[model samples]
Target: MAPRIGVVTFPGTLDDQDAVRAIRLGGGEPVQLWHASADLKGVDAVILPGGFSYGDYLRAGAIAALSPVMTSVRAAAGKGLPVLGICNGFQVLCEARLLPGTLMRNEQQRFKCSVQELVVESIDTVWTCDFAPRQAIRIPAKHGEGNYVADAATLAAIEANNQVVFRYLHNPNGSEHDIAGVTNETGNVVGLMPHPEHAVEGLTGGSTDGLGFLSSVRRFLSVQV
Candidate 1:
């Protein structure tokens, strides 16, 4: 069977469908999961797509992080489930304490919409297994609060553990260390401020670089099996 990957839909999430399509294109079964549902439906992996969940009220993904489904997500993630959080989803992961670091507003105080260049800093995570270290890729990035910040201790820990997964090539939001993405210490949970789902197709996103992210998890699951 194809690896079933779940894409979560929160109240104001706008990118869930896109993530589903990307998962299908990457050779995984796409499962639509509602934010209110507690069961993950036996999905091998889960994706939290980009968008202003809960209308971005109370600080981006703060409210969405408390939804019913997230409770299950946290428990499953602790047991080694692979979870990928993109864009505003990154905020939710941080707020839920699944990952370290807080996503702040852009240093320029503006919403940015652009094709962003990023280098894969590490392939140790399940979500990035298909990528090579230091590999350059381009993907669509649209967000107002994509800048990543962390306390000095947290920064040092992630750096020491090679948890930094991706780094911005041009520093679009002035994130510390040019960090665009990170993974948990176990490498099963990952959060990034770019829309890999949007970049899975060349016709729409002008690049297919993001396919690797989805495919990597499928391959990871197969290897485990």
Candidate 2:
């Protein structure tokens, strides 16, 4: 059977459908996982797409991180489940403590939207194995709070562990170390500020580069099986 990938939808999530389409295009069955449900439906992988969950109240992803489904997601992720968090989803991951660091408002203090270029810094993670080291790809990024920051010790640890997954070719949000994405030590979870799902179709997203991320997971699952 093909890998069943779950795309989570929070109350304010806007990109779940696009994520679902990207998963199907990447040769996986897309399962819509609701925020309030604790069950994951036995998905092989999970994706938290970009959007303003819970109206970005208190913090971008703070509220959604406490949702019932996230409890299950946290547990599953602990057992080496593959999870990819994009944009606000990235914020959610951090809020849920699945990944390290916190996303703060952009240095410019304004929302930015652009087709951003990023360098694949690490391909060792399940979400990034399809890309070659130092490969450049363009993906759409739209966010008001996307600057990633961590404590000095945490940052040092992340660098020492080579956890950085993607780096911005031209820094857009003043993220420390030009980091665009990162993975956990186990490399089973990844979080990025860019919306890869939007970049899967050239006609709509102006680039097909993002498809590599989705495709990489499917290939990983196939190998695992």
Candidate 3:
């Protein structure tokens, strides 16, 4: 059987369907996982797609982090199950304390939307193993609060562990150190403030750089088969 990948959907999630489509396009089975359920449904991997979970009422992803599903996500991550969080999902990861640091409002105090250039700094994770180090890819990013920030010591430790998976080429959001994406110490969990799922189809515009991310997951799952 093909690897079953889960795409979680919270009440305010906007990209779960797109994420599921991307997973199928990448040749993996997409399983729809609900926020209220703690079951992973035997998925081999999980993806938290971007959107204003809980209306971004308190803060982006703040309430979503406390969802019942997160308990399973946290446990699965601890066991080294592959997990990918995008944009608001990335915010939830930080808020859930699964990954390090936090995402704050853009320094310009405005939402930004555009195709972004990112240099792949590390390919050791399940989400980026298809790309070579230093390879550059363009993906669309749209968000109001996407600025990544961490204290100096945490930043240093992240760099030292080579956990910085992707860095923006031009620093669009004023993210500290131009950090666009990062992975956990074990490299199984990754979070990025971009919408790779939106870039997978040519009809959407731009190159298919986002395919590598989904393809990387396919490759990782293939290895298990």
Alpha-carbon lDDT, every model: 0.93, 0.93, 0.92
- Candidate 2: worst-modelled 10 consecutive residues by lDDT: 216-225
The C-alpha stretches of model 2 lying farther than 4 A from their native spots are none
Cand. 1 TM to true fold: 0.98
Measured against the true structure, the TM-scores of the candidates, in listed sequence, are 0.98, 0.98, 0.97
Per residue, candidate 2 scores C-alpha lDDT tens digits across 1-225 of 778999999989999999999988877899999999999999999999999999999999999999999999999999989999999899999999989899999999999999899999899999989999899999989999999999889999999998999999888899998889999999999999999998888788889998898778877888884
User: What does candidate 3's lDDT look like per residue over 46-156, in tens digits?
Assistant: 999999999998888999999999999999999989999999999999999889999999989999999999999999999999999899999999999999999999999
Residue 216 displacement in candidate 3 (angstroms): 1.2
Clashes of each: 0, 0, 0
| Candidate 3: segments with Cα more than 4 A from true spot | none
Best by lDDT: 1
lDDT, ranked from best to worst: 1, 2, 3
lDDT of 1 by residue, 30-133 (tens): 99999999989998989999989999988989999999999999999999999999998899999999999999999999999999999999999999999988
